[model samples]
Target chain A: MFSPLIEDLIRALRCLPGVGPKSAQRMAMYLLEKDRDAAGLLASSLQQAVEKVGRCSRCRTLTEQDVCSLCHNPRRDHTLLCVVETPADVLAIEQAGNYHGLYFVLHGHLSPIDGVGPADLGLDLLGERLGEQVEQGISELIIATNPTVEGEATAQFIAERARAKGVAVSRIAHGVPIGGELEYIDGGTLAHAFNSRTVL
Target chain B: MFSPLIEDLIRALRCLPGVGPKSAQRMAMYLLEKDRDAAGLLASSLQQAVEKVGRCSRCRTLTEQDVCSLCHNPRRDHTLLCVVETPADVLAIEQAGNYHGLYFVLHGHLSPIDGVGPADLGLDLLGERLGEQVEQGISELIIATNPTVEGEATAQFIAERARAKGVAVSRIAHGVPIGGELEYIDGGTLAHAFNSRTVL
Candidate 1:
């Protein structure tokens, strides 16, 4: 329906996470028809990011530098490291603005059915970092992984490893969201909230 | 919260239609983390299309060549020309598969407020094409512009021009879609559907 290059552009656009064929076509047409300069900039930016962005050596979050700004910042509490499944999670925590500690991105949780394991998640590197707990003066490891089955399993695995290194491990609390109505809360979350209720 | 290049990539991804900051970040992260090769291909394809693709000389649709394949095709009915608002509309009609005629893309509708005149919509070129109606053997100009006020005004404007060239002009029907239920359909569409009822 379109020229070869235009068709190729649409197909290539489908690589984005949520873009399907129709959306990809719309995006390709919009770029070609309305915003060529933006398209050019996007192309160069994508290329540059693809070439430069890699996982931070310490935290495993995506970064262009050897050590990410968050990890390198001396003001942040390195003693309290938060473990998460992806860099996006790190961003979410940062946006929430309460955490003053550093982060360790696992990239993904352990999913054996999909063949994702500890090594695939750079757990060995995390283990090495945990081994240096005394030297690094890291007092606590916060497991901020999602509350899915795989996330719980990953948190448990990491907690065991942190305990082996004589470091305390804690999982972030999960209950009904702050503004959520109790009537609308799901059974699992309600049950957990009831069980983990603190004296308030 | 991301590195500089990653942040740039996210910002660039927002140039795509319907991509908000969150979606852009997800797209950027997905491309960088999951598929760098796809990202590279998307970048080159975007750059190539932006650099190489231009409006077809005859029809004004996007194409890499001098004239689009649809315009150059001998099998299509050149005597009937369907005028549309955008290349995406052209693709939509092409995908519907019943139209065997050629197309003329307006790129946009006539909007006096935004200073978009006939020249902006290539109406002068369309006029020239209509002038060659005698030699080209064109019998009808099918106006398939959208059913918006601007689209109707543009269609009326083009209809007058085609009439001056002694070419018959017809607007595509405005009615409820084929599979749509009357109860769920909008009042405007239902009213139009009744107004444009056929003899069936």
Candidate 2:
């Protein structure tokens, strides 16, 4: 309903997740009216990110370099690997500040219905990483995928593969969240919490 | 938290209204990971919009050209001018399809505390439009600003000026909305509804 440029901006803005027509229009108008300079900066930033950023060859996490900063850092535990589903999940773990291991991003979990297999998750490269090629070997493989059914199935598959390759494997623990209320927690989570109770 | 390019994109995305750091990061990751082409398109669109779009010379609404398409259209009733506060408001009125008059955008209402005055709203240009020198005379000026305190005061001021300049002035009526429930309607709106009841 606006000028061609505005309409185009609104249409393009729908590329972001959860933004519909109304929200896109509002965003376009806001950028045009309030912060054209910031809008210009945003435009340039987007173009640069798309052109420069790509998956790290080692871990599949997003990075400008072939090897990501984390993967290239010698101080981080290269002998320990945490496998995750996506780049966003990697960011989440990094922000948590507990993990010091190198990462391997699957980009997606194994979904049989969706035809996502081990190969699709880049397990062939993971197999090479776990193989006893170098004298200095990886000690543990931590499965840090989401706690959903697909994530569990994927973790099981990866764990079996790692064990067959003579490498230790462990899945991230699942129970109630740190500050979660018992009443609001789901039954499945409560069952997991009960089954995996840790002794004081 | 992310690469430099990714971080810049996230920061730039925060320029959007109501989007905080988390949402900006998510949006940036989504664009980079899933839809890089669309992100590129959005970037170009933002740049083009910022470079090209400017206020219409006559109406002060957003337009690419010197004269906006609305002001240039001979089919529209130029003699019946609707005054609004922003380009978004102009789009809203157009979408409603009830009014076929040309519009004059004020950009903002009379906010004396913020030092906004008649000159800020381009009332000088409006005065010229209302003047007697025009071959095709303006018969009426419709004040379609919002129903806030500032809006009412602005409408009153514009109405008085238009009257002095020999142009008829009318304010858009306010009461209960068409789909609004009477029980949920505020007391002031209810009173206005009672006072402005039409003889049906």
Taken in order, the candidates have interface RMSDs of: 0.7, 0.9
lDDT of each: 0.93, 0.90
Clashing pairs in 1: none
- Among these predicted structures, which one has the highest DockQ? 1
Error of 1 at A139 (Å): 1.2
**Model 2 pairs whose backbones collide:** none
Stretches off by above 4 angstroms in model 1 are A133-136, B133-136, B181-200
- Tell me how far the alpha carbon of residue A130 in candidate 1 is from the true structure, in angstroms, after superposition: 2.4
Residues B1-200, model 2: lDDT tens digits: 57888889999999998789889988988898789999999999999999999988889888788888898888888789999998999989999999988899998999999999999999999988889456577899999999899999999999999999999898888899999999999999999889998999
DockQ values, each candidate: 0.85, 0.77
What DockQ does model 1 achieve? 0.85
Tell me the tens digit of each residue's lDDT in model 1 across A51-108.
8888899999999999999989989998899999999999899999999999999999
Against the hidden true structure, what lDDT does model 2 obtain?
A: 0.90
Give the best candidate by lDDT. Answer: 1
Candidate 2 structure quality by residue, lDDT tens digits, A142-191: 99989989999999999999999999998889999999999999999999
